[model samples]
Target chain A: MKRITHFYSLTPEWQHSFAKEMGGELIDNKIIVIPEDIGHGYSYFTQVTPGISVLYVDFVLDTPIKITRQKSDNELYIFHFDMSEHVNLIRINKIDYRIGTHEDLGLAIIDNKMKSTFKPAVGDRTLAVRLLVDKKLLDEFIKTHPSEEHGNRKISVPKKSLYYYDHIDSHSMLLIRSIKDRSVFDSSFESYLKGISLRLLGNFLDRYEHSQAVKDEITDVEIESVTKTQTYLLDNLYNPFPSVPFLSKMAGMSPSKYKMIFKKQFHNTPKNLFIEEKMILANRLLQSGDYKTLTEVIYELNYSKLSYFCSKYYELFHRKPADDLVKKKYNQKCITKSTLQ
Target chain B: MKIIEHSFGPDLDWLPHYAEQLGGKIDGNFIIAPDNGIRYILPCGEGISAFYVDVTYNSDFHKIQKNRDTDFIGLYYNLTDGEATLTARDFMYNVSRWHYNLSVIDGLINTDYVVKSGSRTYGLAIFIKKSIIESYAKKENIVINQIEEITNPEKNTIIRFDRMSYDSYYILEELHKQKVGGPIFDFNLAGTVHLLISNYLRKLSTNKIILQTVNQTDLNNIILIQKYLIEHAEETFPSIKQMADMANMSESKFKILFRKITGSTPNVFFMENKLIKAKELLEEKQYSISQISDKFHFTNNSYFTSKFKEYYGLSPKIFIKHL
Candidate 1:
């Protein structure tokens, strides 16, 4: 670990999300976008090289890095990823920084920088890992995303597992180190995406899940119940939502503590989360072509203000629910009743 | 063949009251009537095969479990919560398909499908078979084409497509529509699957895949292994060295003809496979810029997210939720 001053450009996600509003570029090409959120955190990143020329950012946040998302609406996003492969080397920066989950979320590095990647020296370039995830869906993800436990181990990571090259050394980690931490392209404007390869992740989860801290505190049953609660919230998004007090009673968590844990784990207010859920349901519902106006969705969700609901929907989704109806041109029956084919 | 009785409840004696289908699970004790014969019993949520393995149950599962994608992901979502008024049977019925339906997955290619771009995956997995064009090529006599079968193919390649592609829809509207009879492997909606399989085999013969010693089972494992490598390079480094270490074999022998079996060099395979997770996260718009970066172990947020934008011509976030 070398001590030096360091700066890391915001991952391309910020630009990707705000590209139309704010365009930018990358440095060193060391970063890779994970293409997923850290659930309650911002996103994922990694380091590629052990090069001395690069400046590295400290993982501990004695300092605050200001991050800005599109100023449309408040959205809560969830991302679950694993970085146990890379050796986690926490270093002392002597810099007073408290990294908050509300900001860039969790970032794990693989480099053997146990000493210092950035300190004292004003300019230091550090190796970085990269990842990629969709933004707009994340915005909408703020809505209705459930606070679920990490159960099913599809992709298994070993417990407290860290890789330091005992194998043929494909330098496979090198490629992960290679991709820049920026959004590749916002070219495809897709309203939906299906990940066929998700099944592979099951194994990674299967292996590492046994040792991770998530398993230690919450029970699988508790996680399941949380998921159920989220589902119920989505189903009734359009109706007057149950109060947090009532919801806490239902989930068996006290209202105050539930709010704290839920937000810490999921990074969304229950109400905001509920609104997001209703918005998604609204999308599916509006797709059915039955609801002709955004006003109807607002009415369905039992919002106090129609404009507030519409604006909130736009912020969460970065699009209008009514707009989908206009584009599809098929009324509710046609949209919902279409053959599954 | 007789399908055995599979039901689950909290107690071993709780039987004769419920029936379960393929993958139908309960938050209680598990029961199975094995097709291989005899009754197999285990606790709920166990991955035990009909023989040998015992189900793993713990009071702590509620804490460790995250999200799940199963027929009953919604049912076991919350167990023993006093509000779980509905019976497990009803929930099963809701997500359960009396008979599984097969459809070709279709949507805007990038929107509905994903190709992994990380190290942890096997090989390229087409969400819906891209053999639509090849299927047409086969029917029209393309001399360059041939089909090969996988005996114990890679599980990644063996995955199911949940929707029909637009091309298949075009073929379906024009051709005679009929149900695919017999085994799941026999079904071909637009000949896309068969063509895809054949193309895979042909590629195996000529391209990166080498037959090695011509052993059939190894060939299948190689194919599956190739798929696994192709789909998860970013997240995995199960190289010849890793496997050799696991199996206590020499790396030299492992490297000599490794490519002969899978076709591509391990390094290339690793790179290609990593994309699967990267691409999947890139399309699921719910993730933030940095979230995607860390999932695949991109060292730098700026670099990872930038590469993502460069690869797809849009940031991971914008590309999926396209602004």
Candidate 2:
């Protein structure tokens, strides 16, 4: 049998076989499974807290892999935070959902079989944190202490359900970052991990309970179109910008309907989103020091007038492009001087 | 500014002078009216500390700095209509009401905290020493990299905001309502503080990703609508138009967002919440069937009984009798 390094390759009955194949040992009910000849990645499952456990997989993939796992009997709440730049496909309920880099925080319930294709932008690393919680414990707790204030109205974990948020809030981001921090592996490693795990679960549930109350009213087709519109806008940030009507046509919706759905999905109007994307790209280019001057950045962003570009840059970053350039140069000079010294 | 520090156990001398020292005049235990505001720090156990503060002033007058001797993680619970801003290094945060924030502070860093005036504010601050947290983490076998970073002497402070769970909120409310002081008071205070700490730790662990998918304005509106529903749970259910008007959202958008943020439609959510409250009242066994139904504004006892049975699969009388 071929070695199963990636998660998608493992079938339901392959767990024991794979464990034996990899010479993996179980510690505290957790099997550390390392695939044969896979150098940079390993996956492990550990029961950190009572009735709660985590399946932490970290890998730098060399080749793209389509992984599918059959949903088990027990209900599982999975929080997927992808810290990579590449977009991955997660198909659930016959809808292919796109999980973008750091931009999408996925809260999904896997009661039925599901498949996820992990395709990275060649050579780039894929670092994702997936937290799984037992549904019994969570549901029991919610049943006893129902709070309309906390938005704990009803939690129905269907066989296949997927929820995605565009951005993780600052607090959750910090906590997640803290989990990824490698410095704190002391004697209390297990306790610390459990503590962080439980806290992360609580935070996710709190937000999920509230946000899930507001169901994603858009259909799968609408979501796909909106997602496509978003991808098109991002891809053409530097190209001649398309009008709302043109993009709406691409989405197969009337211009007005398209704008409404797009805004609902992305939280920004098409025009504003386009400008934001351009400004982000421009900022990256400026910070990279690839563009020698502000004029170069303006041309790179396809802006005709330097003043208009500068104003837009100022509006976005609260500083002019020339000022940022000067600061960047000065900072670089200081770093160089320090290195030389 | 005056600084009053009292450690837990027998002596609480600093408690008496606490209000006065911080430019405040006290009416007995509570700080009545102050020239500005008052702060009282009461350290508890090994590495656990508590601070009680109430402020009402027009400007940012008091700047309370943590003593530079110990590094601690601060749990700040703000119960105020006004804003409490904490500025440390590059970040400035507005501490929202009824929400608890966990902050790891480097004693060496120049972190400034000020409560803006024009609103009366009351809150509790619990600070657990990094060593205590480390010790607890060790005992529990928890691996928190943030704790390691926070323990480092050179790193800046870290803060995360989270809402108070219903259980914790009730406990805090109970603690606040307890006016009597004695052995019972001490026991209650200690137990409540421990519960709050554990609650904070649990919250910290389960918060994986903080996604602000809903913008602040919408969130605030949703919160307002929820508060209205909860506060008037006994009253007649408000119409969707009334709720939308209150939230300043269009009726259709409001309905969609309300259901989106809350898993049930407006009427269902309201009815379910009302029934839940009715169950709680029934469990108390204080009120009669007619009184309970009247209180909840149910048209008749039969209607209330039907709804209660639908929710819990048991009649109110049966549930009460079993209890």
Candidate 3:
């Protein structure tokens, strides 16, 4: 294992130091392509706007590499997105944290004062996007756009070093995916990236404000329970929604406490999440075209009564199952017709 | 008809001007529409501004005249059902629905258009400083023909009349579906506008699209054919020979002119509008799939399903999931 240490910053000096440590050469004054001996891919850095910069690193390591950033006095917030093909691992102030599996992707925000180390799971592609933003700028934005939780109150950042990590909401995730999927059109790529960066910053500030308003400290044990409950719900989506009491008992917590913690952690009610997932699954099944009739789909998912299933599906997806079936068949027919022609 | 004159540019200060004219109040970056719809004005950057409006006028017709003091390049996207006539000086064009709807014009002079009411008017306008675009073009070593023409500054020369490609359409859809509020909403709107501008620039970079000014009479004929098709969307599509005869032109000439103006064949245009109309009926929830197919004069339900799926990427039955 090779370990590299550097003082924290998103400037040329810091980028050069990291590049040198990784035995790579800096190119175009903005990118450092990884040396073939160590990995494939490159790290790109850009100043989106004043007070906000983005550093995107993507590579697969032939050997394990750990990058450590020494604690600094700069008041900055690092919004890190780990989009690796597998689980992404990191340590903040000697506390270990693991995340970024496809099903469990999230954003991790760390205060600049805390020493942090990134230990990506190797032999697989490691993709990460980090936005370095000035704390003062973030505070200014929060003052103008107060979260619902902290309505009309003058919110301030506490003196304690902040380290918060949570699942990226679907909306934010969609924005991130759009950014990733964009092809570089040279003329306006910078402006395009800057626009996406602002969007991400805006979303983060809102989330941070809401997080600051919550006074209760969530424990590791509680997080574990909530995570386990989420996995259980996702796995049993085909089955009817397990009652709150049933889930709470499994999590070894009171029913009301469980519900509160679930909402706080996932930002969704248990029943709503279950229904949403069930509908999503139903959509996939209906699109698969293996099932000829909507009734077969309803029965396959343990649903009874075509009308009841249609209403629930409509409530969640706003479209009927029958339409999806016809859509599937129609698409197949078009494919055949085109080929024949 | 009501006349509403307005100007939009780099700053959002023009929002107040619009609010005062519309009898609405300005709320931060939004114009709280008095009753009909939503309006967002976003200042994207130093020399870029974007505006989005989705409203149905209480009046039957409104003629909006845009008069700008400064020279700016305006990228306008008209997404409403075809109910608009864009008049840039003497060159007049009817707004095509979705397809071939992007119009880029130099806003050096006064230009006005008429928008009919009773249906929603959804559109986005992006204003960019002409100097900024010139500097960008020079720095990037790319020359857009229309940009150079701006050196002499033709009064109302349209830079390009093109279709919104699939990518642009997807971005527009995302913009329409945006649900965030507050500063995030502002950022999302601005970011999306930049994306649209970026897409427009990318298309221009290829230098394939050029200034296309059609004859007024020819444009009028195309508009007439389009309106006729839209009106009879429920009926069977007229043959190209019949349409050509109706337009008083040869079949090949009529086909070429229609494809050039609309970016689609006549049959495709008719069927697309028909499917869209069928989608609206589906939203009404008054008819079953069979009933809609029968009403549309399709041979059978499966054929209707295939056509709907081909055009919408989802069968009418399943596409309702979004409604």
Best by lDDT: 3
Better-scoring candidate (lDDT), 2 or 3: 3
| Top model number, TM-score | 3
Write one digit per residue (lDDT tens) for candidate 2, span A95-160.
Answer: 666664434443334432344433333355555556665567666756754666434232453432
Model 2 regions more than 4 Å off: A1-341, B1-20, B23-46, B52-61, B96-111, B116-118, B132-156, B211-214, B236-289, B299-323
- Residue A280 accuracy (lDDT) in model 3: 94
True contacts kept of 2: 0.00
Between candidates 1 and 2, the DockQ winner: 1
| Tens-digit lDDT string for candidate 3 (A45-151) | 77765667887677788878888888777777888877665787778756777767353645778787888888877788877778888888867776786457554
Determine which window of 10 residues in candidate 3 chain B has minimal summed lDDT: B150-159
Model 2: residue B240 alpha-carbon error in angstroms: 7.0
- lDDT leaderboard ranking: 3, 2, 1
- The TM-score of candidate 2 is 0.37
lDDT tens digits, residue span B1-323, model 2: 32333222113334444444555564543454456455444444555656655566576544555454445666666666676676666656566462223344444445566666575666667766677666765665556665444333354444444455544554555556544333233334444555567655554454433313456687678767976897899999888999999999999999887766554688887887787677667645556677889999999999999988776555677565433
Best by DockQ: 3
For model 3 the local lDDT of residue A168 reads 62
Rate residue A189 of model 3 by lDDT.
Answer: 61
